[model samples]
Target: MALWGGLGQAATVAQLVGADVGGLISNIIQAAATARQNKKECEQLARRVLMIADLLPHLQDPEVMRRPEVRRPLTGIDDTLREAHELVTSCQGKSAAYQFVMAGRLADRFRDVQSRIDSYLLVFPFISHIDITRRLDRIYNILLSNDTAGPSSSAGSQLDVLVSQEVLVHRHGVGKFTLKELVVATNNFAQEIGRGSFGRVHKGVLPDGREVAVKSLGKASSQHGWQGLLRELDVVSCLRHKHIVHLVGCCVVRQKKSLLSFWRKNVEKQEELLLVYEYMKNGSLHDHLHGPSSSSSPSPVMASWKMRIEILLGVSRAIEYLHDYAGVIHRDIKLSNILVDSSWVPRLTDFGVVVNWDEA
Candidate 1:
């Protein structure tokens, strides 16, 4: 009855909440300088950015992550950061004067977001103004790099875009999986082994010949799942033990339809959500307990009393580790959630409804 398990069913995106504040600031500063229009305004925007830049280290501080208070403000700032990045991106190919206008508008946004975060900082009193000032100074040095006014007047070109893409990769811990790669690994999702409220689960074989289970969340399920995705990802990423299921990675592709573009690229877009996990060789304990088997008779591999007690002990230990060591609660424990390996060792799985023990 010994089972090994990890407790994540469908993680929402919140677990991926960390933003490279330094990178975002760099992008905005670089873009603004290239679009040189109002030198005074550009400097003003740079100063304003000092506020958000100062908060970067604190936002990324391990202690800050431990506090739920930071999550809301951080999320708010994450939006502003993304908006600033996109605003700078959209300014590309625009006139210098237009870029200046966009930069001013974005600076105002940075100020507003910073104001909101300042209030959140009250909870983390140890994060001193001096700490922020030092980070801001570092940002100032970076912003004043000689790329001002940009080169060849095409400052908003592919080179800048490539730099931004590079920063994007550093933030995603599990590494982004391409839709094409996933297509090949899942054999076009050809092998369907189970279905659930969230979506279908397909047993897949990676390019490296490793077995995996890919769970695809339907649009409706994703809409609901987004509420808890980040927390799940955060919890599962930290959990490492012999009895827990391992999360290899995940895929979250989004698409939207558009009319014919200037280059006439395809307008069709879609949103696909997928979670990848290590394949459990022996399926779930529920299957062996009360589920169907190959021979339609009471199999000799019956749940002996000794094996049953061992299974209970294994599950208890898994729960104990999650609760005491990980500060996580296995919220949806059941027979089906306990999976098994080739050795009849039970592992825990499916953490769709987990909660931080402290919060609980």
Candidate 2:
């Protein structure tokens, strides 16, 4: 049983909800505080972890954990904890300057966790949620005080604004298709292939009989997902890398037809957004490395260090392209975001939450 008063629902694992946030905190505390930057970043990450810790116990209720809606946010939290654990541990015994460099990466990870927690706030008790926007404001002020950049172009201030912040999406780069086309391709949304936090994906065959994966955004997150789709289209449409998911087309179905009353109208609520991509026969690296989704046995090919290193290198190149050439930040980079094909080659997907360096 969980501590404090008995919970009505079976407790969802605290480790699952809170993940390694606490562990990261303790690890940082034990490490030698060599540089001002290292210590500052450590404190900031601890704060983020503490915010997550506050919500952990409350989310243990079976009612909350059992909800399908909670799965996505929960997975994101788990991924963050995993990344933090790796990062903090890797910094051990490094020089003060090296740790300082790692601090920069930690900031990126903190913002990624910030974006992940937004979805979690929707489904459960995030009643004490911290205001991330205010956190960004603090960074902005700090930059101004330090004279890092002029008011017009504050680099620290830009990074302070979370990737979840709204932006004007553009459409000059990608193909726009209608709902009819999507329906025809998916055979009326047949073949339930997989699912993610935003929506479900269906396997489809194109007019040329080429295989594809169609992702449909969920209703509750329709607006959020649309913004992401716009961002994804803008990013992926311009990039051509072997390790990047190809953006075949997209669908946005909006209806203006109203019932008798405005209050009863299903306007934006009824809209649908879908994105099409080339199908990956092997699904995701998460499935292979950890184990098959439906089974306990790990994929032998992926379990090898040699294969894993190659997979890691391919993903690194793709990310380098996004950062160095495309000039965008992939706020969400987790195992599930990396897909693999029949040859077990890794490819990056889901660019909706990526922020341009300028936009930060």
**RMSD in order of candidates:** 21.7, 22.2
RMSD of 1: 21.7
Task: Give candidate 2 regions above 4 Å deviation.
Answer: 1-173, 254-271, 293-300
Predicted candidate 2 versus true structure: per-residue lDDT over 1-360, tens digit per residue:
121132222235443454444444344334424324445545555445455555555554454455455554566556665655455455555678776666677678657755555555454443212223234355445544644343343443343232112111222335666788778988998798776546778998888888899988755676556556655655677888999988787665533221101122223324355778899988887777675344466574545998889888999999999899989888889988899987888899877688999998
Candidate 1: misplaced stretches above 4 Å?
1-172, 195-197, 254-272, 293-303
Candidate 1 C-alpha error for residue 289, in Å: 1.0
The alpha-carbon lDDT assigned to residue 38 of candidate 2 equals 44
Task: Give residue 242's error in model 2 in angstroms.
Answer: 0.9
CA lDDT of every candidate = 0.58, 0.60
Task: Estimate candidate 1's alpha-carbon lDDT, on a 0 to 1 scale.
Answer: 0.58
The TM-scores, one per candidate, come to: 0.48, 0.46
Question: Per-residue lDDT of 1-360 in model 1, one digit per residue for the tens?
Answer: 000010111011134355555555666667756643444544455444555454434444444355554455446555665565555455456677766666667667656645554554453344443334444454334323523443442432433333223222322345456678788998898988665435677898988898988877654654345434434554666688878888888775533211111112332333454667788887777787787666666523264777667778888999999988998897878887887777767688777668886778
Clash tally for model 2: 0
- Global local distance difference test of model 2: 0.60
